[model samples]
Target: MLHLENLSFSVHNNGDSKQIISDINLDIKRGKLYGITGPNGGGKTTLAKVIMGILTHTAGHIYLDGEDISDKNITERANLGIAYAFQQPPRFKGLTVEDLVKIAQPKLSNLSVRKRMRDVGLCPEDYLDRDMGSGLSGGEMKRIEILQVLARNAKLAIFDEPEAGVDLWTIQRLVDIIVGKYQNNPEAAAVLITHNRNILPICDEIVVIEEGRIKHHGHRDEIWPIIRDDIVCQVQDTCRGEEII
Candidate 1:
């Protein structure tokens, strides 16, 4: 439902330009779980930010559902049903899960909230009234963050490494939500930037980003073995960023 055409982004400092994303042409479809992996600073996160309008692209266009959104701001993009889940969820010590969900989707009912909480392996009875203070573990916070994003009912979701700081149980829950819920829902699409081997194999497609460009992308069965070992960012000379055809 999202199309990126010849997308390129760069940064300028002291009159010197450094390219971060280069001509990244991609089509993200509904009901597909895409896994993005590459070396450090390979433009994976940058691309996600660009698509979410957090970072503007220097050239090319971004179209969502046939409408050009290249010039939309972050809030505008969010309104357009584009959601981004950061590597680290924000800490809101005084807010409860129910409060957060209400803020995310004011029209949502308590029944829907309960269902979403259960989908993420969280018990609404136990978590909805709890504070998001230091009492909540990293896994709990991450799951709640995911829940908030899901509450948006966004058509396209970009998750920047959901497995980054969570425990194995949380990671497992993420896998379950992606495999069970995300895969079954044809109304939305999700892009995940992850190096976790377990997460990679479950994706519908694997996209290898290197040197600010899409190096290789294909079905998981075809691309998994090639990147399984290299997902750790080996940074070999041959694998450095370059726009591969």
Candidate 2:
């Protein structure tokens, strides 16, 4: 399980301060898929980075499985079974897909690598031999990143917009891969940061963040109505004041 207690982070821009996250608190239970959605500039990505240790916190605490990991570095957190797939994946200049997977799972055989890629809706023969560099499309890079995470078998996986850049047909496949992975292990938990409503039904809980704080958190069914109503009202208001030519 993962817990954030009074977590806060800020940045100083030219002597002016801006808080990305403010006194946020939440608990994610084991084996559940948690979804985070909010408008842009709402600190959702910042929260994900804070949890993965990609960004240091200005204040508050992060605990993983009852142990405080607030001070741990990225490698330490990864070694502790935490994996994160960034919104924009980094490309290794010389590494091939097979090489990355091997690095993630040294003991994985060629058969296993193929299976993992297949699970993520990739063609193993074509992709495994390809270099994981600039040639691959964004969707491919995202899927490759996910393959590495799956290969690592991390207990807690944080995926930031896994569906981003992926085609609609592939998005369903990506969701299935995520669901299958977590369903395989009861103790494995996942945090899915996405804005697409298509994925909401697949999650156990949805945490709606706005302006650096958690605005709502509850079961998908319970939270969907409020979110839907708010979105509809906003759209209606925006369209009402527009004048026709």
Candidate 3:
């Protein structure tokens, strides 16, 4: 389980402190998938970074199971079975897909690598030797990033905008991969930071954040109806400016 108590993060912007995440609290359980959804710039990504130790929280405690990891760095958190898939997965100019996956899990076998590639709807023969640079599409990069995380089999995994820049078919495939992996591992947990309504139904819980604060958090059945209604309203009243991804 992961528990965050009054967690907050602030940064100095021109000598004035700006809070990106403020006094947030959450409890995420193992063997479940948790969905975090909100408008862009609502601090959903920042909160994920704090939990993954990519950003140090200015206040409060982060506990994984019963261990306090508030002061841990990104690498330390990763070593403790916490993994994060970034909104924009980094490009490795000189590495092939297989090379990068091997680096992510050095002990991973070729067969396992191929299987993961296939699971993400990529042909291993076509992609295993492909460079991890501009050659791949946004959807490809996202899947490869997800494959790396799944290969790690981390106890807690966080994926930021997993459905971004993908078509409907690709989104469904990505959802299947994420949900299947989490469902298969009873000791592991997943946090998905997504605006895609398709991903919400698979979650055990839904957390809604706005302006750096959680507006609602509860079981999926209880919270999703409200969220779904909001989405419908937003669509009906839309007139531009980045519709939810």
Best by TM-score: 2
> Each model's C-alpha lDDT?
0.87, 0.89, 0.89
lDDT of 2 by residue, 1-245 (tens): 88899999999999999999999999988778998998888999999999989999999999999999999999999999999998999999899999999998899988988988888888987888888777999999999988888788899998999999988888898898888888436779888999887887678889999999999999989987788787788789989979989
Flag clash pairs in model 1.
Answer: 211-241
Q: Output the better candidate (2/3) by lDDT.
A: 2
Q: What does each candidate score in C-alpha RMSD?
A: 5.5, 1.5, 3.2
User: Candidate 1: where are CA atoms >4 Å away?
Assistant: 92-94, 123-126, 129-136, 229-245
The candidates, ranked best first by TM-score, are 2, 3, 1
Best by lDDT: 2
lDDT of 3 at 86: 86
What TM-score does candidate 3 reach? 0.93
The deviation in Å at residue 215 for candidate 1 is: 1.2
Cα TM-score of candidate 2:
0.95
Q: How close is every model to the real structure, measured as TM-score?
A: 0.86, 0.95, 0.93
Tens digits of lDDT, candidate 3, 61-170 = 99998899998899989999999988999999989999988988988888988988888788998999999977999889988898888788899999999888766777
Q: Judged by lDDT against the true structure, how good is candidate 1? A: 0.87
